[model samples]
Target chain A: MADEPRKIAFICSKGNLDMAYPALIMGWAALGNGVDVTIFFTFWGLDLINKARVDHLEIPPVANTSMKMSMMGIPGNLGIPNIMGVLPGMTAFATALMKKKMNELGVPPVREYIQMLADAGAKLYACKMTVDMMGLKKEDFLDGVQDIVTASDFIDMTEGAQIIFI
Target chain B: MPTRTYAGKTVEVNEEGFMLNPADWTKEIAVEIAKEEGIETLTEAHWKVIDFCRQAGLASGKAPTLRTITTGAGVPTKELFTLFPKGPAKKVARIAGLGKPEGCV
Candidate 1:
């Protein structure tokens, strides 16, 4: 039997710009498939759907081989030194470049993509443990978040769904 | 270089069962493949799903994922499970003569 997964769940634990897209894109794709989808944002991943910080999420180009400057039409293999990755402005530069490439490829920005996922009926859950740990309120989240949930609650919501943790 | 005698016609396929050349596909081949997958019957609804998958596969130049079929083909998830049974995406692609879809649970 092909395990034919109809329900999909994502646990987004990272807040970085690049770290966020994997779960977001996959979640969006699941919605496109007419599958039931849910995303649980915890810790720094909360920034992905945070009311005031989503669009401002940063992608650190440090230690990432995939962030090719050449993709931005620079036409060179001059990789950014690991040391430079720790410098100020490097993160912003990388985020801008990555966002531009994604835009060229017709991928929506993080905020819009999250909204699209929600609009497509993908549910969002804020982790209760992290919420309390970070002293966040429900109002800290964007609209369309289904609830604040514990791990057990998440397990119930994810029954029979393929769960991906990022 | 593997092959399968599908629908009494010799067609090339990979070891994992994806058609090596999709042009060899036909409705009769789909029927045989479906039977091999324990789907003894292909109703009109099944045809709708299969046809949609084939067209989407052509457009994308790859196997359409389960999500693609449900979203683009307009088939609901429950109906798809009922129609294709186990491994809907894999089975549908094999029957439709597309490569086995790469991403899944």
Candidate 2:
């Protein structure tokens, strides 16, 4: 008897534009490998699935170390002064630059990326706790979400599967 | 110093059996490689995927992630698993004569 294919679970807790891609890309790859893949979006990460707002996720440059360095055209390891990250329009500029680069690399924007993941058969979920806290309904999420599940339920479902927190 | 002879050609392969030089691949080599992976026969569906992967690798200069094959090749995810079984990406890459896809795949 052959064993079942491997499983992979992704937990995404942050909502920044940069924080979102890692989980999405990995989930897609897991599906490619014929692995069972599940992703739970909690708290701010919930933004990745919210039907009304998921597409509008932003890149805030304030207090962002990498964005600051990139804005100054310096090596990523070099940090810019704190005052620079606080400048008005810095967030917009940072967001625009990152968006541009992703476009050039043929990476889909947020909405399409989620669609692709769903198309590839990766399961998406929303945190029930966050949903109640935010007074959100299931309808608030996009079409691909499997369900809004509690943390405990998610843990149980992912048993025996490799879990990755992003 | 490792090699595998397929289709009467002895070619360099890695420990995992992927061809060290993708250019060494041919249709006969694909048939031989598929058999070595426990697929006794490569069906049309399998060739569809292998052909897509080879073309994508040639265009991109790297192996296409599973995502690309599903979206670009139009093979649904479920069918991909059925065609290649476990370790689909690695298996397809090996048979298609491309490098292993990086990251989770």
Candidate 3:
């Protein structure tokens, strides 16, 4: 091991079901490499730490241009038309399909990932400005959240660390 | 690939020192690898994780990820960290004579 452990910090600003996994997966991998991990959740990303919203996150297909028919097990290079994405229950369908695929690969749910990261010593923080803007209290966040911190505080805390903004 | 001696037995290992062949593993080799990872003593708890990882890794042809070890081996994530500090998944795999776990979680 190096004299000082490598440090990587992720700034999560989105909260879609698909968007949430990138930081979690990368952070877990970093931990396996003995790197220090810190994650800051701001804006819509605060939903990840919110007790009421974390598990119930939905992946809205609308405006998600990358969504393809192949993701739904259809054989084609065709993309799902944004027109169809606006239909009722499309978000639910998309979220369910993604969750099923993840489960089949033995991937844990979002809440479990958060718990696992916490147990493995990753530092999780909710953005204080977002929390205040949304009128959320500390109790509204998950158990793993260390604290609600300002953007400046997060910058100071992650000095000299590789930063990934998502 | 590189070969290193552990417990007087030469075995193939990767550049990072993880065993390339799970069949070449032994209890003595595990103890020696544990020492190299800064764990001087292998407690019963440590052996439980090691045994589970070895069996699971051999059965699956790949080492188990941290989540698999916790759920499949019935070890708590935090306890696994205490049993094998720094990086439990990688450290346990190295000591258990298994390939490095390839999963992200």
By DockQ, the best candidate is: 3
lDDT of model 1, residue B100: 75
| Candidate 1 residue pairs in backbone clash | A33-B67
Give lDDT tens digits, candidate 2, residues B19-42.
Answer: 888899999999998888788899
User: C-alpha displacement of A89 in model 2, angstroms?
Assistant: 2.9
Q: After aligning candidate 1 to the native by TM-score, how far in Å is the CA of B84 from where it should be? A: 5.8
TM-score of chain A taken by itself, candidate 2: 0.90
Cα lDDT of model 3 by residue, A1-166, tens digit: 4578899999999999999999999998888778899999999999998999999988999998989999988988899999999999999999999999999998889898999899989999999999999999999999999999999999999998999999
TM-score of chain B of 2: 0.93
Q: Show pairs that collide, candidate 2.
A: none
lDDT of 1 at A15: 93
Stretches > 4 Å off in candidate 2:
A1-4, A69-81, B7-9, B36-41, B59-61, B67-82, B102-105
lDDT of 2 by residue, A103-127 (tens): 7676778888787677667888999
Instruction: List per-candidate RMSD values in Å.
Output: 5.7, 3.1, 1.2
Write model 1 residue lDDT over B1-105, tens digit each, in one string. Answer: 988998789999999788888878899999998898889999999999889988888888788776567767888666776687545667788889999775542
Calculate DockQ per candidate and list them. 0.07, 0.44, 0.75
TM-score of chain A, predicted model 3, versus the true chain A, to 2 decimals: 0.97
Lowest summed-lDDT stretch of 10 residues in model 1 chain B? B81-90
The estimated TM-scores of all candidates read 0.61, 0.83, 0.97
lDDT of 1 at A35: 69
Q: How much is the lDDT of residue A150 in candidate 2?
A: 95
